[model samples]
Target: MFNERIHRLLKEISEAFADRRDPFNNEWLSKNDVSIDELHQLTGAVSSILDGFLAAPKETQVLLLSVGMAASSFRG
Candidate 1:
């Protein structure tokens, strides 16, 4: 069970680029004198993610919006 949990955590961290360090932490990026061009493979990542979401089917898009609304409701 512990190994399984560690595997899942590692997978999540990898997906979020936790191994890269600078992308998620502003202070680290600034401290290291990182410019926009040197963002370690994150230059077009947002555009790609947004494009993929936009390219998803309309039904899938509606489901995504609904999920967002449900999450927002919980934040209130």
Candidate 2:
């Protein structure tokens, strides 16, 4: 997920999971110093960005999603 297209969007999630926290569980994040409110805000921003991307031409969206994506996301 360090594709630079989305700026390593899943890196933080990977980190939480590697640290033995449930990234999908808000309770885990809340109890582990991650603010749910901030997560919500960041999600909102991502949603907006995706919406804008969708509004672009089909070629643009295709290029953005396909180019420079998925260089590496796993290290085990």
Candidate 3:
């Protein structure tokens, strides 16, 4: 489940990069000379860190999920 969550985040990041006209798209990253592979590398690091966060208390887990959802909504 944790890995899935990380994958979902990475997917969102990819979609954001692939689309430019979309309101929630990451135009800033695209405009600033960011690459899709760079985003993947960044998320890879994040996933590693989040792996430990996943082992925390239930409250922390809920917080992580909430943050993830918020980010998704922002992406949309």
Candidate 4:
């Protein structure tokens, strides 16, 4: 279940990049330092949250993942 979520998230992130209106102009991936792996985790956590897993103690875990994602997205 966890691995499935992770894979789904990665796909979404990759799709987000591919669907960008101006892929070349945005440079989101390069400027944000968003790695494929990090994107996978972020999307996974976000998916879990949307699926109602972001409750009580899980909220903290979700927040941490979000922070990690943000940091990694700008790791440079």
How close is every model to the real structure, measured as TM-score?
Answer: 0.40, 0.50, 0.39, 0.34
**Count of clashing pairs, candidate 2:** 0
lDDT of 3 by residue, 4-36 (tens): 544655565546544643423477455544567
* lDDT per residue as tens, model 4, 1-76: 4566455545455456545543223374566566677666675665675565355477777786787578557643
User: The CA-based lDDT of model 1 is what?
Assistant: 0.54
For each candidate in turn, give its C-alpha RMSD to the true structure in angstroms.
9.3, 6.7, 9.4, 9.4
Instruction: Write down the lDDT that model 2 would get.
Output: 0.57
RMSD of 1: 9.3
* Least well predicted 10-residue stretch by lDDT in candidate 4: 17-26
- Report the alpha-carbon TM-score of model 2 versus the true structure: 0.50
Best by TM-score: 2
Per-model CA lDDT versus the true structure:
0.54, 0.57, 0.61, 0.57
Report the error of model 2 at residue 38, Å. 0.8
**CA deviation > 4 Å runs, candidate 4:** 1-26, 53-76
Ranking by TM-score: 2, 1, 3, 4
* Candidate 2 displacement at residue 19 in angstroms: 15
Global fold similarity of model 4 (TM-score): 0.34
